[model samples]
Target: MIFKAIFSGFGGQGVLMMGTSLAHGAMSNGYHVTFLPSYGAEIRGGTANCTVAIADEEIASPVASEPDYLVVMNAPSLFSFQNKVAAKGVIFLNSSIISERSSRSDVQAYAVPCGDIAQDLGNTRVANIIMMGAFIKKSGIVTPDIYLKSLESIMGGRKKGVAEINRKAFAAGFDYVKD
Candidate 1:
């Protein structure tokens, strides 16, 4: 199976991290993966995005012209990437921050309140992880257990207590989608 996904948001919103985490998870599970990140000049609030390709076979390229899945954390990202989603694709949006809806009817939409969910979990920075959880649940790209372990491995020595906080954030997102 092959899956192409794009995660887009502001610079500080962990958009790249989300894609990186997915790539790591896919790689750990014996999938071929590629991660490519793009960002604007400003560090915190400027546009940032990444494309990740996961497949059982070799990846031909890192660029994703039309992705099967999209995780957009803001209205701008939705506007920018919505049209590029493949037919029958799935789009997950941070509805708490973005009031706009997708115009395409062919793609499935999951309007999870990622920002609010992260805030409720006492950390707004983890909104991306919340989205990640929802994506994991809906798409079945990677199992939660595998993703959690990959997350922990990726967070090694990043900061104190960050792994646990992110773990809780991911669980919150996963539960939100299941319900």
Candidate 2:
């Protein structure tokens, strides 16, 4: 199967990290994948986004002109990428930081309180991880177990307890939608 997704948010929100994790997971599953990242100059609060394409066969391109899925971490992201999604595509919004709603009816939209969930998990930085959890749960591009393993692998040689909190954040996001 071919799955094209776009993750967008402000800088320092881990938008690129989430896309990279998905790309890594797809690679681990023996799928061909491509990731393209775009961002502004600022380290934080500037626009940042990434496009990831995963498929069973050779990928023709890395640009996601019309992605099958959209992960919006803020209202601006939702507004910017809402019209770019293909019909019947899925959109995941971080409702905790964004109070607005999408105007599209042709696509499936899920509002996830990623920021609040991360705060509840004791670290607001993992809000993107929470979003990743929700994305994995909703998109099914990769299994949650595999994604978590990928996350741990990426965090290799990091500070102690980072994996535990990230795991909990991922689980929180995963269970948030599952329940």
Question: In candidate 2, what residue range of length 10 has the lowest lDDT sum?
Answer: 38-47
lDDT of 2 at 129: 94
Clash pairs for candidate 2: none
Instruction: Residues 60-129, candidate 1: write the lDDT tens digits.
Output: 9989898999999989999999999999999999999899999999999999998998888888889989
Q: Which stretches of candidate 2 lie over 4 Å from their true place?
A: 39-44
Looking at candidate 1, the ten consecutive residues that score lowest on lDDT are 38-47
Each candidate's clash count: 0, 0
Q: Rate the local accuracy (lDDT) of all candidates.
A: 0.91, 0.90
Candidate 1 at 2: error in angstroms?
1.5
Q: Which whole-number lDDT from 0 to 100 does residue 80 have in model 2?
A: 94
Off by over 4 Å in 1: 39-44
Q: How far is 44's C-alpha from truth in model 2 (Å)?
A: 4.6
